[model samples]
Target: MASYYLWRSKFGGLSVPEAKRLKELETENGRLKKLLAEQVLENEVIKEALRKKW
Candidate 1:
């Protein structure tokens, strides 16, 4: 797909090594983002529970 290529191009230029590194970094970045989101949601739920105390 044209859109897929367009999005993939944003990672790196013509070098294969660069492209591989870019993919690795993107994968790590996504994993870290997911972890952060989970922690944020957990914090919110705990906060809500605390707010309900008499």
Candidate 2:
């Protein structure tokens, strides 16, 4: 449970642009985390491939 005023103030004194930016950053962060996980999996696959080839 959250209060609107508190949320808005945290986003920057009740500014719409600030709220939007916060949401955008959150979304970007989520995407980056997902990408990182994918890259880790890819790295493991590459490592296994190298181990077999060399």
lDDT of 1 at 29: 100
How many steric overlaps does candidate 1 have? 0
Candidate 2 local lDDT, residue 11: 67
Please state the error at residue 50 of candidate 1 in Å.
0.7
CA lDDT, candidate 2, residue 36 = 100
Off by over 4 Å in 1: 1-8
Query: For model 1, how does the per-residue alpha-carbon lDDT over 1-54 read when each residue is reduced to its tens digit?
Result: 998889767854547787888789889999999999999999999999999973
Q: Assess the local accuracy of residue 1 in candidate 1 as a C-alpha lDDT between 0 and 100.
A: 92
- The runs of at least 3 residues in candidate 2 whose Cα sits more than 4 Å from the true structure, single-residue gaps closed, are 1-14
* Residue-level lDDT tens digits of model 2 in 1-54: 368667755764636886788889999999999999999999999999999999
TM-score for each model: 0.75, 0.65
C-alpha lDDT values of all predictions: 0.86, 0.86
Q: At residue 49, give the lDDT of candidate 1.
A: 91
